[model samples]
Target chain A: MFKPFAFTLAAAVLLTGCSAQSGAETQGGGLADSLPSLTGDYVWTVNAQKSTVKFEADYNGAFSADFSRFAAAIKLNPDAPETGEIHAVVDLSSVRADDKDVTNNLPTPAWFDIKMHPVATFKSDQISKTDAGRFIADGTLTLKGISKPAALTFDLKTDGNAATADGNFTVNRMDYQVGTGSDFKDESWVKFPVKVSVRIEASR
Target chain B: MSASVKSTYTKTAIWLHWMIAALIIGQLIGGKVMHAMDPAPLKFELYQLHKSFGFIILALSVARLLWRLGHKPPALPDGMKPFEKIGAKLSHIAFYILMIGIPISGWVMVSSSPYIIETKIFKLIPVFDLPGVPRTEGFNALTKDVHEYMAIAIAALLVLHIGAALKHHFVEKDDVLNRMAPRIKVRR
Candidate 1:
């Protein structure tokens, strides 16, 4: 009885390992290898009124800041996601925290350094469809005079003349020199991983 | 040692009374010390803990009030003066009012404040603001003053309550203190 049970457990473990390996293989495979590349030029204007960018930081407790002003330019073909291009600019000065003290401190030199770098930009170099209605944009994010490569995975829904894209990604604040000195140098107060989320509604 | 003396309080009442007393004292100290500290992560954590305890005090006060309504407390010792009885009743009434008022005022201040930080009980349970409280600077300041003044009033009353209990135990040599004290068996 013990021998048969051990054999069954081994088989189960092997099947789980094989399934996980295949999942990784599918994701690692290039988008072009799985889907046909669409080849059409389309322009979409980001509706600022319906769009929002928010960042959540964990400092003993979870708190979020919202940016009101931003602009984006998108050129994509739904049939050809690989041919898509996205460029966006976020007004760092427009960041607002729910707490008055945090809101006042956010634009100081220790944090966003909004006086020196008032704008953060993201330019996507490649876009790939990972699953139905799901896509990932591999891009460069420039903030506080530092540029770093970041990947944003988003879900897209298009209806008639309107399209909406929503996604979230985590960024290490230390990488961009945000809150780099004194009390903020360590993870004692504010954790490094800040979750950034975006919801963009655009019109063709 | 007679059973008819009725010298002790019900176990549930005694437990609630002591629990609320200990928590309130700790909360008052935490609130004062945390307020004096500068704005830092530790200060923030202490304030959250203070707020959590404030709500716990409120819940316990409500439960204690309900229990008091259902059960009569042990009577004062025989031959107690009329003025002393009135003083005791009035002071006990004030204690209950302050116990309930301080936390409610704190809740109002938090709910009305323009600063929109979330209130979590013990950093675990998320609590929303009380409805209809205006989120304005003027309103916030008013509620804050109320909360602070009421807290001071509670502190004053706590001193008096403890002093009265001590007097009853040491001077009057009555069961007033023993009614709320933990039960202890005395060997013959």
Candidate 2:
């Protein structure tokens, strides 16, 4: 009876040990230990000349627009990415398209409704390093008074004192009440996904 | 063949003529209505469709011109006066020129437009801008005026052409109208 009890204890210990080892390999470390921390903070100012927010939407074909008027506040430490905070505000009235008609319609009530909601904003709550040279910002995007969680994955390249972040994300126009009750309401005419690309150059 | 019978237009010419006529009429109405509407997504889409149809008309006009060069149209009714025959010939020539000119001018307006949008035919075939056309507000305005006026001229000429055809059919009671009719029998 003692031998059987000893074997059961040994088997239990062996199984627990194997599970612990596999868990470590999968997670790299415990949740608390894996959490990133900030080392230093740097103030970043956007270079307007080199920064632009571009959006693309599909109808019968693909159409794109560029918004030149936007502001970004980024506080980041390359060594400790967890402390970074990024906030951006885009002026909806500044949207411009290659076609004059499309440009004119962008700010109308059926679309961006610049008269009511003139600005779209994003505030990042957390920033985490996903891989080498890449980071993800978990944030809330508020447009047309509706706030929703959005994650932006971007690649950061720093050249001495200057840094550039290029990233892209997609949002459903319907979620923001844009293009509602218009001919664009039908997905066949205008698709739901509106892809937004960002190319921002900032300096300390 | 009976002496009283009249010759008819060739099948290719007949089809081209009718197709171009229908498209031109539709485009004229669509263009005016779409332009008058306030800027919206629907208006924008309609403009694109109008532009695509304009390009199609341009292609058909080129083919019609080639067909006209190789094949002769049926002669005017012998009862027509000398001046009437000359008028008919001049009008037909004017029709051909305007049919070709309207589309080309519209194309020039689009090419010179300051807005750098791609013109896709039926949202499928991509059309490049005309070579050497500067994309500037002044240039586009000039081309737009030309395009609009030329379209008006085409519309006026169409009214005359249709009225004359109706006159020939009802008043003159001749084969002038029947010669281009869809299913009218013609002598060889």
Candidate 3:
């Protein structure tokens, strides 16, 4: 489902305008946090070996895969998470699925279209701490040349200097045309919703 | 000659025989079509169906083999030479091997694949992968090649199997084909 470039450009602008307005409102009022130890402005270094970004595609059973290469830039004083930003970039070409066919199909035009869109990026417009002591990052995910609203909710656990954040979010593959067109339009073969889970181990 | 009498197959045996035959034929064709097509959602669906039918064929083969063990099949038609009898027995053995081997190899191929895809029969029945089977590229490739070649072997065997049956019915004018034939009025 290739939307015209001109039309999508206009839509992108409109979506961005809405996100910015909502972001401002959320940031102005949502700063309540209870995790005092996590309240710091230190730039954490992600331990690549310990971090994993995986997505599951439901077919017969879930066809699970992980992006071998991904990076996250998180600036946060967990006590005032509203002022922080969460930016993540995943190299889609580095996706490895447990099924060879799925791994091969992911880069094709009907799937991730890696040749055209090699990287999927998420930039948070607003970050907030929940009462349950978890954090949520409201962001725009740019994937396959299309941008859509996405949110990542994570539980941040700090051990002295090291921090581990594990979270999961589901995205409809149909929205970004990840697995659309031909027979994939139906949910029979491969389901539409792809659950993306992330574990980031980082230290200041 | 008394050991080589002709008799119609039992109804259960005949049913399992024909059901497996029909499913095997479908699986063969589906396998070929799916292998030749480019990777797409339809191809994926075909692959799944192929696996489902493969499992069905394997299960029916097991049942047929078990049934055959308990209930003796009609012996070879009278007037057949010793060599012919041995050939028929050996061919039947080979058929059983392929019937079971092809599907198992396919199962192993999927199981040992580095990209862990769960096997579900007809998208309804969830089948687990071979336990303790390490997921390795080499193992997966070996099993894949074995599965494909065994399927080809079965195809070749089918030509001989069907041709021999046809020969028995038309050229030899024997009850060999009719023994397994569905609802043939064998007036002896």
Candidate 4:
């Protein structure tokens, strides 16, 4: 009898200890905390009306949804892309799918868990030019409070003061806990990879 | 009321009967399989296909009803009791109502859902939602429940209908089953 009670006490203590650590970690940090300070010649603000942030969750079939509201700030010089920085904030609650059922369930715990983690963020640590008009921004993508290293490659075309970037990237859905459970392990229904595509129109 | 009472059903009646019967059974099984599935892309596709089948059944049911009205069926065997005859008639009426109700209810449920996925029949023909249907969660849930109950009712009706047909064939030893038999030869 006493052994069971002592075991229960130990488990409770361990659970509380874990929660306390996580709580502190989540509250203490902000999305921009780790971003590199940018001092590039051109600071571009993304036009929300003109830009689109969409994701495709594919298994055997493809179901796509879009983040209706997102904002990205870029500081870069076309000549020195290595010194550039990109930061984007996505409102997880604003995700809308063509199917109403999909839209309603997206903010739930199985997917974005928008109640607990309402915002997803990306802040680049490195930006490198692979070719004349193409660049890759490697960054930490924080979603549902889980951070993972991700990369976005885009073709940048600049004409005078206006610029456009069309990019696509793939991220493992399981890595960010988007659909991690016994049911989703096989990936028979909703596949593991989620493709995120972005088109940004911005000006200095 | 005709001078010569027809002993067997017309070819058109037989054709519609078997076609609708096969489709309804398929819909019942497909509905069960799709409902138990986890929410995924394939599940969504199955639902769209299911919707396509539902509409097809609805259309066929309409055609079947019209065909039924224009063509009087062969008279029941002389020995069928009053209640049995009534039950047979009632069950058929119920089937027609259900075949029509099930698909329409499903359509209403789909229309009411807040998430609007376009209904593409077999991923080919685009079928639009019923106009003026309220797209609310409560309405959608209610319609879904109604659709499910209608499906259950149809399943029960199927058991009764098949049992009656089997009884007419094996126990009653009549030509009732022979009327709808696809390729059976009969002496006029």
TM-score of each: 0.56, 0.55, 0.55, 0.61
Scored by CA lDDT, what does every candidate get?
0.71, 0.71, 0.71, 0.72
A65-87, model 2: which lDDT tens digit per residue? Answer: 88755655566766576767766
Query: What DockQ was computed for model 4?
Result: 0.15
What lDDT tens digits, residue by residue, belong to model 4 across residues A115-142? Answer: 9988787767788879867778778788
Candidate 1 chain B has its poorest 10 consecutive residues by lDDT at: B1-10
lDDT of 2 by residue, B25-127 (tens): 9999999999898656788789889999999999999999999998888888888999989998999899888888988998898888655467889999989
Which structure is stronger by lDDT: 2 or 4?
4
Docking class of 2: incorrect
Model 4 chain B lowest lDDT segment of ten: B1-10
Candidate maximizing lDDT: 4
- Candidate 1 ranges beyond 4 A from true positions: A1-71, A74-204
For each of the candidates, give the backbone clash count: 1, 0, 3, 1
Measured with C-alpha atoms, the lDDT of residue B19 in candidate 3 is 87
Candidate 2 residue pairs in backbone clash: none
